[model samples]
Target: MSLSIKQQLIAQLDRILSAKLEALAASITSTQESRDSDTKSSAGDKFETSREMAQIELNNLENQAEKTARMLNELKQIKTTSTATIGYGSIVNTNHGTYFLSIPYGKLQLDGTTYYVISMASPIGQ
Candidate 1:
């Protein structure tokens, strides 16, 4: 069956988030491998610096993965059906643009129409 605009938007978000999570996982894995393979050379300071850098990168990637996972969970909770009041998962149409109150991902274009996917916490969403 054909999906509504909201459903389509949710699907798109899922795809985006899933891809981001995968990429982050790959990055984390690569960083861990690099750090593990790092050998202590004559220059101990250089080796320590490399390990520290890798750890920092891994930490950042892990944090991003956690955030993306939370966003995916949020998207899964969204109901695509129309709502009487504007809130999360509501699709708003205005003269300026169409907005989907789902995540912070911005500027979605579908079927020749533009949609601004915004989080309620954002200034514009407020």
Candidate 2:
């Protein structure tokens, strides 16, 4: 049995998300180290400025991590098999067009046939 297009997409997204999350984690760690070092050497205005910058960076990383996590959850919720409704992860086929539920990437093979990869937000996908 071949993996569905949706499954392939989810796998790709998962890989991307995991790498992103790892990078974010590394950023958080580096930020923490900088904050610690600045606090030890600086005082008054300089210390406050460094602290604020670090906090802002941390917040941004947190927000991005949250957004990525939500996207992953949404992908996980997508139904693999549907009669013909277009939704996230739906390999849609219509009289007017055909689309695979995938990230905007190159050709993908499923069951020995090539599919045009398209993200859920693509013009043809919507």
Candidate 3:
């Protein structure tokens, strides 16, 4: 069966979100490895610095992952079949506005025109 535009958008968003989650998981794993090495080497100040840096990186990744997850969840929450209205997974067009109904991944070309990729929850999308 052919998928609707909304379904296509959701699939795209899911792909992006899965990659993001994998990256975050990898970061956490690396951080844990570094912490373990620091403990084994007893590097003192250097160890502490590395640990702090890893912690900071992990925190940043967590924040970004959370935001992406929320976007994905919001997309899943939307339930509409009309392409006439702009909602999650619904590409929208206006006289001066063009937006994709998924995560903002920058600019995309559709029908030979550049449309700004935007998350459905973004102000531009709203």
Q: Worst ten-residue run, lDDT, model 3?
A: 1-10
User: What is the TM-score of each predicted model, taking all chains together?
Assistant: 0.93, 0.67, 0.70
lDDT of 2: 0.69
Per-residue alpha-carbon lDDT of candidate 3 for residues 16-117, written as tens digits (9 for 90 to 100): 777887887788778767766666246678767877887788788778878777766776776545655546656666787766666666675444656576
C-alpha RMSD in Å of predicted model 1 compared with the true structure:
2.1
Count of backbone clashes for each model?
A: 0, 0, 0
> Which of 2 and 3 is the better model by lDDT?
2
User: In model 1, where do residues sit more than 4 Å from their true spots?
Assistant: 1-3
- Which candidate leads the pack in TM-score? 1
lDDT of 1 by residue, 47-117 (tens): 99999999998999999999999999999999877667889888888888888888888898888988999
Question: Could you report the Cα RMSD, in angstroms, for every candidate shown?
Answer: 2.1, 4.6, 3.7
- For candidate 1, the TM-score is 0.93
lDDT (C-alpha) at residue 8 in model 3: 58
Error of 3 at 34 (Å): 1.3
Q: Which ten residues in a row have the lowest lDDT in candidate 1?
A: 1-10
Candidate 1 whole-model C-alpha lDDT, 0 to 1: 0.88
How much is 87 displaced in model 3, in angstroms?
A: 4.7
